[model samples]
Target: MKRYLAYYNENHCENRNYDVVIVGAGIGGLYTSLMLPKNLKIAVLSKKDIYDSDSCMAQGGIAASIQDDNRKLHVEDTINAGCYVNNLEAVNTLVDESEEAIESLIKLGVNFDRDLKGNFYRSFEGNHSIPRILHVNGDSTGKGIMDALIKEVKNAPNIEVIPNVFALDIIEEDNKCNGIVAYYKDKFVYFKSRQCVMASGGIGQLFSKTTNADILTGDGIAMAIRANVELDNMEYIQFHPTAFYSQDFDNKLFLISEAVRGEGAMLRNSSGKRFMKKYDNRMELAPRDIVARAISHEIDKSNSNCVYLDATMYNRDFLKNRFNKIYSECKNNGLQIEKDYIPVIPAEHYFMGGIKVDLYSRTNMTNLYAVGECACTGVHGANRLASNSLIEAVVFGKRAAGDISKRINYDFEDNISTINTRNNPPNKGRQEFDVDFLKLRIDLKKLMDSSVGIIRNIDKLQNALNFVDEVLFKIENLKFNSVLDAEVYNMYLVARSIIESILNTKDSIGSNYVEEYSRHSVV
Candidate 1:
């Protein structure tokens, strides 16, 4: 591993340069940085603490066709789950490289759980035909993986992990990404880089309740929109069918991993009767889109806030051993997994649309790349298959790193000549009107949840778009002093994009269920 030297300029706001600047310190950013040539100077930025990412919140394991399953079957399952709208090349790339990604993680010291025979323990998830998902610490897969990757990152001399930094915008000149202007250490700073990787995760925070971490405010997608980069599939937002229902209605919801259902937990109505059989023949093993919609429909019909997931039939010891975190959370919340039914509801979970990128994770703009939830590689087209997100992050993250390394020294000086050197300062003025960000955030969440959520219609979509447009107008006029203000602005942009996308897409497919289109006609 070679190390590159870095120097700071006299101006405090300018010239903190790096060979590569990766926005968002989730699995994608961390894995990409680790995979990059160690000779290049890399900077990984996180809006909050590095560990406070959606990746760390993932309870289910990464999916891969590593055991009795084959890559072809995995690819077919992914495409089928995506309503056959997935980009074939990207799907192939993801499936073909999944084993390698898993192996790389192992080499980096990710301690995946193993059985008595020293074989990796694999579990099943919704929509998967085979038991291909791998876990760690029974169910704390994300935490285990992140702990290892974080340790590896800290030991890498060429990588710098900067926390409490907000990337405001991607700085582009002459149609090429030069770097980013971000708020760091209570001041705005320009980080010049040869390449920029946008791995800033998803937009789950826009909704009132989500499995995503609070830090996920669609920063990467919003920045890409600002940079005039291509975005796609914005209408496709995956709602997990079984997030724990709480009366507090907090933005961060605890996800009851789909593996629970895969392991024989049954979705039942308030009357303690099984319900999924009516929705789909696959029952609890149906794809996430179907399951989520079923739950939403059940709630609407029953006029109840949530349905129940009955896991009492499973052995208590097995339940505790396999889903210790979920069991403990339920116990702490006054619902024991072994004796009581866990209340569950559908909540916004994953975004399948974002800054559009090619198979190599290269965005439309030069010197820019995106991976993870922030990048639409078309691998998870209309809806994502369960447990595929973690593997997608590792696969595309490595591809982005590899592609960037190959093109790292491609006459950057010549390209620099085409860029205009201009210093854009951050807005420092306070607004005359006091905007209630909390109220606006709540309003936005309700608006999206009611209109553009699991089910959609033309009228509701239009109403949501109109509301978002009104908020965007106000956000543009307001001046911000903190990163929180910027986050609100970004949320407005992302929410607007999603509403607009739903309006533009005419057909119902996968998670995007438009009322105008017949389900049989599309699905």
Candidate 2:
């Protein structure tokens, strides 16, 4: 969680000629960085330490079809789960690449959970017909995978991972991405590359309850919108059915993985009722959209603070060994999982809409590419499946890299003007800009969480958009340097992009429940 301070100079860099400049250090960005051709110059930018991202915070395993599974069935399940709105080409590509991505991970030394027969163990998640999810160390799959990738990336030759580099906006020239204008420290530094990839994750942190890291504020999505990139289904935010409700943090919830349901955990209400059965026949095994809506419906009817997840079906040994993280966290909070039922409720988790990109990861902008959760490839239409987030990041990250390698090189004009600053020459003074801008940022996050959270109607969304529009205007009018100012500006842009997108979609579908619009039709 260490935050570094850096300054970018308009002039003093030895290696300014790069083929690609990526604006995130998460798995997607890092994977692209590593998979890229060794001869091509690549730079990865991050606002904080590389590992400080939602990729690391992910608790579930990566979903893929490996042993004896059919890609056609996988595609069918994905399309069915997404309510048939998925782009078949993209779905096929993602489904087809799942095994390769899993094998790639294993080649990178990722220690996936294994069975007694010495096979790669898989588990079943909601809506999946088979045990296709390949987990690592139970609930710590993401952490284990991220650690391996980071180690491999650090030793890579052609990649430069620049942490604490905040990408303010995409530098688009003549309708093509030239590079990005990022503040490295207090100074506004410009990196001109032919290709720019945004793997900047999601907007979960903008809400009150989420399982994402704080860095998941839709930065890349915002920057793309500022550059006029097309965003699809912005309102399709996926709220996980049950999060461990914390009474201590004013009901701030933490994730209790869907795998618990796969292992037979049931959802119960205050009156000791298994309410999910009343909503869907699948009960706890229903898709996240149905599960979340059912829970929301129950809460409305009961007028209760939250629901409960009964994990008593599993034995104590299984709970302690398999779900150690969930067990310990609950115990530390003065609740025992084996005895007391875990208090829970649905919370904002994943956003299924973002800067729309094609199968090659190219967005509407000519040279700009987007991957990870930040880019909407029309793969997850209404609701994202249980563990497809990590898979999508890897699959698209690879495609973007492969496509970028075949493109012609971009050359920036030498007459680029630098931002005016006087704290330590034009270069180092950029680091001296006011850090208090980060405080204003906290206020922006509060606004998003309060207004644009799980359940939204017309009035709340319009109000949220109005506030965000004003904030964006204020940000444009402010005098600030590269460091915190750039990051805040980027966040504001992403917030507005998401809010605006959510406002445009009329119907209530999936995680996006619009009370005023009763229709579930998709345009």
Best by lDDT: 1
Q: How well does each candidate superpose onto the true structure, as a TM-score?
A: 0.94, 0.88
Clash pairs of candidate 2? Answer: 6-184, 6-185, 185-431, 186-430, 186-431, 187-430, 187-431, 424-429
Q: Tell me the tens digit of each residue's lDDT in model 1 across 99-138.
A: 8899999999998999999999988888888889999898
lDDT of each: 0.86, 0.77
**Candidate 1 displacement at residue 143 in angstroms:** 0.8
- Shift of residue 459 alpha carbon in model 2, Å: 2.7
Q: Which candidate achieves the best TM-score against the true structure?
A: 1
lDDT at position 430, candidate 2: 28
Residues 1-523, model 2: lDDT tens digits: 0011113333442225567899898889998888888887889998799878878867778889786897787887787778787788998999999899989888988999999999988888888878888888788888888999999988888888899776766666567777787666655566877789998888776665777776766777767766677888777888898888875653135689898888888899888788777677788988898888788777777999888899987777888777777888888888878878988888878888888899999988888889988889989888888898899999999999899878745443544444222222232322332346666677776776666655667887788778767766555544454445656776677677667777777766666666677564211
- Decoy 1 TM-score against native: 0.94
Give stretches of model 1 more than 4 Å off.
1-12, 414-431, 520-523
RMSD of 1: 4.5
